[model samples]
Target: GAERQVRLPLGCHHPLVPLHLHEERPSYVVCGGAVFTALSQPYLQHEWGKAWERRAPVSLVAKALNGSKAQRGEQVVLLSQLLGHECVRGYDSALLANSMVRALNGVPILCLAQLAQLVLACRQRSLRFDLEESRVLVLDTAQARGAEAEILQQHNIPEPVLINERDAALLR
Candidate 1:
């Protein structure tokens, strides 16, 4: 991946941001249940989502990025910019475990593909996905059997990505 500049529109409130190459975690969430810590950051995030949002669903995620046309669905994918857990702002909270606490009940990650969809959506709406870190994404593994990044402002948690260490080992 190459380095580039991106500008944020709504929640970020930033003009532009610099993105680095290979700076993101490689973890992912799995399609079935259970979390595997040995995986990379992107993989972990993907796997967790799949387990949590399979068939019968729960809540959703919505992204109002500058250039994205917001997606409307009970089951939508999260964007890369909106990936990291939110930061706590209380005076004491900042110094304490507030950051962790705020994330105690939030989606904390996504993938490159999810970020792409977000970028497309923003581009469609004339917004920017300026250098977002810790992004979230939705994977339609059931249909495509592959990961696809989607930045839905009004979407539920995405189905977790499948983690098959045996197959991954083969690929490596």
Candidate 2:
């Protein structure tokens, strides 16, 4: 009989697995008073403790149980944390955490790298972030740019943004 071969879909093992995980390249981005990162099982576990599946938000648990990549090189980018700043005033509610980012500047966000690019290259007067559950976050572009350095310093974040080269290339 002739040799038989089968190919399985990539990232089929786990729905919450991050698209990119590397030491040199960070999987997170900090900009405009928000921390963006890809959703992963470890993050869920860390945030929700040992009983993450049960303790975590129902929306997240549902994604973990049944979510799949709709397109190649896709990642579940999320607003992991919100920093206090005038640029992001009135959005300090804790409910914003772990909310999946739907789009930035009306462009769909596929990965963390893409989100970073959208933020850094935006020339509009404001940066709009569309999130899950009909939540919308808008920040003044000039204020955000000007406040980023101060926000980083206050939080002691070394870099404003860090993204994997491979992930960045995928968007291009």
Candidate 3:
């Protein structure tokens, strides 16, 4: 992906951030549920689908950035700009742990662009998209079957133009 400048809105009061996948052990949370080293693409989609069904508000969901308090703080600022919401909240410890904690508490954590993709899916039934990393998408039995290909085709996403071996395997 091409790097681009990001600007926070006038009242957002946070640093600009890039929309990139973050990987770091420090940011890793000890989520109290079934923890897999990696989650599949379909799993992630189903999780997002569920969130949409449950009406999880994107405004309050803290983004997963490079594992740091400051970067995490920047998420709200970025979100305020993206979602056009004013009066943003600062990062909460609980929200910071949301992705993992949700898994522990039996809700799938939609990581990376999964949440955004799911939101897009609700409005547009067909579109193409890319996922930079594998995220654990929690779903029930019915929702789990054949979700990845269907979602990818709906979004017109092709095989990645650039990917490392690890990520390639995860996507497959």
Candidate 4:
């Protein structure tokens, strides 16, 4: 399968990346099997993945919200490689959109779950999140997974980081 990716206007300086040097050569994805199979892998510390511990799913969701419209060539490489311990991975479109929206506005991210609901609500009720190079986001469209859908249906919900059980359960 061709994994879809939207490159943000950051982190294009992969010196040894062959495809970058020779555009004639097609780029191949470094497959991350079982997404969390090697979550303990080593990585250099940087600002890239600071949210894994600090904001987690919420931060990621916000990123996705902001990433929807990034240009074709620009992309943000995952800052840290010690990756894949949660449902919200670097390529998760829904989570990235959520995070991107939050980061762009400098707003307090109260809840990932509720935000996910809001993400869907915006689509249903005509709210829009700003993002680019859209990832295959399911938070709004995957209604077969009833849990998130129900959350969207609720009223007077509080803000909180989320791990949509229905969505998470499907990934597991």
Best by lDDT: 2
Comparing 3 and 4 on lDDT, the stronger one: 4
Query: Model 1, 93-166: lDDT tens per residue?
Result: 11221011111113221332332233323322122222123322222323212222332121333543432342
CA shift of 91, model 3, Å: 26
lDDT of 2: 0.81
Candidate 1, residue 27: CA error in Å?
2.1
Error of 1 at 62 (Å): 40
Best by TM-score: 2
Q: Relative to the unseen true structure, what is the Cα RMSD of model 1?
A: 20.3
Ranking by TM-score: 2, 3, 4, 1
lDDT of 3 by residue, 1-172 (tens): 9999999767443322223334421111111111122222223233455453234334222232222224331222111111111111232323232233232123233332332223223332222122122222222222222343443344353421223333323223
TM-score of each: 0.16, 0.84, 0.21, 0.20
Q: What is the C-alpha RMSD of each candidate to the true structure, in Å?
A: 20.3, 4.1, 18.3, 18.9
Higher-lDDT candidate of 1 and 3: 3
Q: Which stretches of candidate 1 lie over 4 Å from their true place?
A: 1-21, 39-156, 162-170
Model 2 per-residue lDDT at 46: 77
